[model samples]
Target chain A: MDRVAVIGASMTKFGQRESWVMDLLAEAGEACLDDAGVAPDEVEHLYVSNMASGEFEGQTGIMNALAHDLDAMPAYSQRVDQTSSSGGAGIYAAWQSVASGASEMTLLVGGEKMTHQTTGEATDVIASITHPVEYKHGVTLPSFAGLTARHYLERYDAPRESLAKVAVKNHRNGLDNPHAQFRKEVDVETVMESPIVADPLRLYDFCPITDGSAALMFCPESVAEQYTDDYAVVTGVAGATDTQVVHEREDPTVMGGVVDSGEQAFEMAGLEPEDVDVAELHDMFTILEFLQMEGLGFAEPGRAWERVEAGETEMDGELPINTSGGLKSKGHPLGASGVAQGYEIYAQLVGEAGDRQVDADVGLACNVGGFGNCVITTIMEAAE
Target chain B: MDRVAVIGASMTKFGQRESWVMDLLAEAGEACLDDAGVAPDEVEHLYVSNMASGEFEGQTGIMNALAHDLDAMPAYSQRVDQTSSSGGAGIYAAWQSVASGASEMTLLVGGEKMTHQTTGEATDVIASITHPVEYKHGVTLPSFAGLTARHYLERYDAPRESLAKVAVKNHRNGLDNPHAQFRKEVDVETVMESPIVADPLRLYDFCPITDGSAALMFCPESVAEQYTDDYAVVTGVAGATDTQVVHEREDPTVMGGVVDSGEQAFEMAGLEPEDVDVAELHDMFTILEFLQMEGLGFAEPGRAWERVEAGETEMDGELPINTSGGLKSKGHPLGASGVAQGYEIYAQLVGEAGDRQVDADVGLACNVGGFGNCVITTIMEAAE
Candidate 1:
């Protein structure tokens, strides 16, 4: 199999956007195309990830709209939606297509327009990310997160203060990320005092539903070599699923997909956990960060919270995770979260992540699509 | 690279359903496992496709729910969505994963539950498949199809009844399709007289918003070798994206991704258009059949309607298309439509299509996701 590389990547400042989804996608996509120094016409294929355009903006078939908006005539585009992990899946799909010699250059774009709908409407839109049976029984994402958080507390004997540490770390990191939505730093007290949406999962424990977009330019290793002397080589990519309905999982903490994806990705990259210098784990909910840290093999089982509370996941710590603020502080524009994770990793590995720069040669991104149903973990190295 | 083959496949009868999405997914998945003669324990990876649960059923993270339901602890599952073509893309993703040596045995499943919502509610749910900008302008699937149908009629100077011919052919073929949603015969007059949802596109011309599912089990040829003497070998798999917004295309009839997929699939298969004995084209709308025929290079530009009127694509005809009634008569449950298309081709290639079986050594399936945004086509042949 041929190696697929991320030659160029970009993201619009992740935040509440008054612009249309197409505009956000275009800005991000154009940034990627121009950054790669590739002419727009050189792009052979496009993938767009938008989770709930119809409810948020009453729009659909967004790929075509973006193409027309971007003047990418005759170029192909597809929209990928696996909720929050859509961006990661888009990259995975594009990588596979490029690896197979299907296209010379592929653009993976993800964004959402959440502000178009009122807060109540947007909340309802986000609620769709839950299991219908479980959701109909009044289970919101917060409620689900609460269950997971409760389980983690039960399993690991971790204090709620550990969860507060995650928010403090990511928010502090966000202060330096121009593309992050929430740049304001907060202390553990702020997180602990925030309104509780569900037991144990406070407002600060959840990522805000902000509108944003991120884009990545993918090419075969050969094409990538021509595109740039320095790039993020996708050494490994893997995606796995557990179940759509949360209740069906025998062990919610198992997060089988994340574990599987991480193992497979590490195998493909020919690297071990110790090789990763930086990490971007999906933190849609504060508890998700703890779960991912453990499931992704970065921390010992039930040990992520302990490590997090000790600032082991902070910028100066070993295995620094989510230096870009993560979904918790960077904003969770569902489809864009996963892709945004990639954008941050690429920046960090390329030494372009100015303030939050970690001395990193290898970076990994773990994003879960709609809970743990679809989880993808990709490992990238500084271009050889 | 490892070769991927279909070891098992099954689907729920397409139509309105009282069952929940999990129930439907479980039923279809269980049946697929049984058909493949493999236990759920034998599967290593899972991919589930569903377009909308939040709006239609207020569900999210369906994979997590289903994983618990299946009692396949430690096995991984992931959710994927690419509009109506989700199922096809899901299968393609699984195949690529297996080929890339990620997993030996993978299960791909897709389903939807729209009957739970009212027709108006369902319309809003289905309309999510359109471009967000266009959708806000009150655009719908039928409206989009109407525009395409008009363009086809004016561009090709084909009779309006030519549109009817597509439904007539598929419905006639559906009569022999036990799993078809509409298996009754209808004449051109009856189709022409059907109530118009959008001008020039009638109710009969549209695929119903369905609650159904289809599943396929994929394994490397090495592993599948032990399963059965005869199986459907995935000779070629290709996916490409087109403009998601309909109005953005320079020529709406010309699908870049569909054409690209066709080219790549044919090249990978070491075959040409003429080598296909039968095909299952994406006919989400009547005009889509004509466009896909042209896109697949099965017919000259603007001549698919003429070919259809000549009965060249009928069962036992020169090129049988949609012997499983395509999406028109076969219920289309967004994500399931693509996988269902793959299942049909698998059945046809293995000579298990029952009464609708065509004498063919090779079969093809073309599934389009959300208008023309993403398209995945696969060419298959029976194992020797």
Candidate 2:
């Protein structure tokens, strides 16, 4: 099988923008093509990762619209939706398009337009992904995060201050990310004093409602030289699903989808978690950061909080994580968050991440959808 | 590249059903697994083709729910949405999963539950795919179909009755399909006399809104024998998009997507249209059948109407089309319509289409999304 290489990547400013989803997608897509020095005519396939353009904007067929917008006429296009992990799913689809020899050049753009709707409407649209029974009880994703955070804190006897550190670290990282939604740094005291939205999870502990888009260009490794000398090959990519009803899980702290997908990705890449020099884990909520760290085998089952407390996941730590501010400070634009994570890892691996650059040859990204109902893990290595 | 083979296929009764989208999907999925004698646990990738579960039922995360419902936990699942052609898109995704060596066995289930909603509501949701500019002028898919039909009839000097014959022939075929929505036959006079819907085209010229689901199982041809000796190999599959705004088309009757996708599919299959012994063409509107026939190279550019008038597309004709009834009679359940088209072609190729059996070794299915905004063409052959 042929390996897939990332030849280009781009992301729009991860904040509320004036452009609609289609415009945002085109912005990122055009920039990505420019970055890779590839013409729109050369793109064989175009995949859009978006969760709810229909519900959010009363618009559908955005993929076709995007194809027209990008002037990539007659190129095959499809919308990939896996809730919030849609971007990660798009990565897998792009890889398959190249690996299967169906496409020589595949372009993936993921975006979401949310700020136009009220917070209540946005939350309702997102809550639709939860189990009907759970949703009927008003159990949105933030509520799930709160419940899990309480459980972890009590079960592991972890200090609440550790959770606050996640927000602080991501915010600090955001200060260096020109595209982040929130660039101002916050301290542990500020996060701890913030009003609680979900019990034990303060407002600062959760990602904001954001609108943005991100894109990547993928092609077979054999043709990477035609694009650029510096590129990152996707060594491994895998996705998995867990029980949709979150409460059905035996352990609330562990995300089965994350564990399964992460293991598959690592095994496929022939690398372990410790070999990952840089990482990007979905930090939709502070508690999620800890859970993913443990689920991805970066920390023991319940000892991830200790690593955070010790600054082990800091930008200069042994395994720097979320160097792009992640969904926490970078903003969680449903579909675009996962692609932005990949963009960060690719930038880091290719040594193009200006001020936020991390020393890394191998990088990993984990994207979780619907409180870990589904997760995708991707491992990339700097081309040797 | 490994050849993709279809080992199993199933479709629920295409009509107004009490089942939710999830239940309908599970019905087809379980039946397909049973048909192949494969356990759910053995399924590695599950793709759901759905255009608007959220808009129709306010339900999201349907792919995850379906994975859990089918007890296919840990299987990778994603939703493929390309408006009405989502099922065909799902086929492309499933093919990539196997052809790319990402999954050993992939199950694709396409479904839509829209009968519960009012026709106006359903049409509005479907219309969302059209360009906002055109949609603002009240240009829905059916409207586009009417305009295209008017132009084709005038330009080709074709009789309006030729369009009526499409409904007549497909209705006659539906009589032999136990699961078809409308089993009763309708004559050309009945169709011609039906109430006008969008001018030249009448109510009968359009397919009915329906609730149903269909499933297909795909794996490598080398391993298909382990599951079934009567499997069919997907020799060719491809998709393409056209201008999202219908008015931007070079020719209203051309259907660029169909032409592009069909050309690609035939090239990949290493076969010409003459090799197709049986076929199913999207007949969301009577005129669409005519356009696809010509677009797929089955007939000369403007002579498809003449072929339909000559009975060359009947069940016992030279190239039997829609042996299981095209969407015109089988019921257009949005996403399921395309997969059902594949099911018909597969059954015919495998010689398992009982009463409607056609002596066919090769078959083709063409699925069109929106008003020719995007299209997928697939060609399959019975394994010797």
Candidate 3:
């Protein structure tokens, strides 16, 4: 396979925005193109990842909108929505196109605008993320996580406080992240006392619905050589899905896709968990962060919580995780989350992550779409 | 790249259905697995192509539902949606997974359930296939085709009777296509008298809204040897996108993606248009066939209609087109259209296309998503 590298990355502030989603995507795209130092025409192809523009803003064919908005006419564009991992899927798709020698340069942009809808309506729309059969039976995603949390507590004598530690850690990290949704620190007591969206999962444990977008530019290793020193090569990319209906799985705690995707990607990259310098696991809900850490081979079963509570995942600790605060604090804009994860890794690996930069050579990103149905794990290394 | 071959293929009848979309997918998958003589457990991964399940069935996590429906627990699955080319995209995704060593065998399924909504609602839903800004201003897929049709007539002086000729030829082809939606043949007068949905586009000139699914089980050539001998080798695959907004194009008659993707794929396969024995181009509207024929390098501008009218596109003619009735007669189930195209080629190349079988050595499938914003094209041959 031809070497694939991400040469440029950028994102709009991931919070409620007054600007339209189209404008935001264009801004991010422009930033990415500028950073990559490529002309608009040089972007031979495009992959736009936006989950619910039609529901969010009554807009459809979002790829064309982005293309028109950016005056990047004549470039081919396609919209991709794999739920939360849309951004990652877009990047992956672009990578394959270039790697296969179809196109040398491609642009991947992802964005979501939830602020257009009322919070309640947005919640209902987002609830569509769960399995229809299960969700219709009164199981929203929060409730699903709630069940997992309760089961974890029972199965392993897991401390309820450990969940709080995740929220607190992310919130503290968000304090230094200007682009984070909730840029303030929170205490364990504060998290514990927050309103309950689902039993055992407080409102604070859930990532906020956000309006944001992220953009990345990719090129073959040969083209990337024309740019600055190699800083981020997409060494591996793997996506997997499990049961959408939680009840169908014998053990809902077993996020099979997570582990399979991680293992596959790591094997392809010829690396182990210990070789990862930093990690950004999807933390749509606090429990998800814990589950994903285990899924990504960062910890053994039921040990992720202990690691978090032990400060091993802290910014200055042994293995910094979600230094940009993750989906929990960085904000979870459904379509943008996965791409944002890539953007974070790009920043960290390039030494461009201000205030929250991690001294890392290799970075990993894990983004999960609706439940565990779709999960994409990508490994990136500083360009050699 | 490692050779990729379709070990099994199946498609649900093209028409309205009472079963749920996931159920339809399972039905198709079962048929494919049974045909391949491989158990569900043998599938190393899954790539599902679904478009607008959220609007049609209010289901979001389609991949998960499909995995569970197949009773393939802990298997890797991911949903891929790229407008109308979703099925082709799914096939491409699966092809890449196996070719890149991500999996030994992958199941590619593309389906859509659009009849659940009222005609008006369905129109609104599918209108999303047009560019947002252009669509919002009353432009739709039919209208986009109407504009192209008008241009073709004005530029090439192609007789309107040629449109009727294509309809007649494909519907006649559909007579032998058991899975086709429209099996009845009509004369030029019948087509001329059909109701006009948009200027220059009559009802008979358009494909119907369909609810169906297509499934293909593919494996890398190495593992495919373990399956069967009568497989369809995916010799070439390429995808490209054009201007998202149709009106932004320099020439409405020119399909940039078709030209680029076809050229790329042909180059990769070391073949030319002349080498293609049969062609299945996306013909959502009558004139689209003409535009795509030229863009695909099968004929020069304004000459495809002459080719069609002269019987050059007949099953036994120089270059047969849409022997499975295409989107026009096989029905346009949005996501399933692309894969269904591939299914036809599989049948033809395997010498299973009963009455309409073209004794061809090589075949091609072209799929377009949302007014030519994204396009996927592939070349296939009898498995070695």
Residue A131, model 3, lDDT: 70
Please identify which of the two predictions, 1 or 3, would achieve the higher lDDT against the true structure.
Answer: 3
Of the two candidates 1 and 2, the one with more favorable TM-score, higher being better, is 2
Which candidate should be chosen as best, given TM-score against the real structure? 2
Off by over 4 Å in 3: A67-76
Which sequence of candidate numbers ranks them by DockQ, best first?
A: 2, 3, 1
How does chain A of every candidate compare to the true chain A by TM-score? 0.97, 0.99, 0.98
For model 2, residues A1-384, the per-residue Cα lDDT tens digits are 668999999999988888899989999999999999999999999999999999999999999999999999799999999999999999999999999999999999999999999999999999999999999998999999999999999999999999999999999998999999999999999999999999999999999999999999999988888878999999999999999999999999999999999999999999999999999999999999999999999999999999999999999998888999989899999989889999999999999999999899999999999999999999999999
Pairwise DockQ winner, candidates 2 and 3:
2
lDDT of 2 at B384: 88
Ranking by TM-score: 2, 3, 1
Candidate 2 C-alpha lDDT tens digits along B1-384 = 568999999999999999999999999999999988889999999999999999999999999999999999999999999999999999999999999999999999999999999999999999999999999998898888888899999999999999999999999999999989999999999999999998899999999999999999999998898877899999999999999978978888899999999999999999999999999999999999899999999999999999999999998899888888889889999889889988998898888899999999999999999988899999999998
- Which pairs of residues collide in model 2? none
- The numbered model that scores best in lDDT is 2
Model 3 TM-score is: 0.95
In model 2 chain B, the worst 10-residue window by lDDT is B244-253
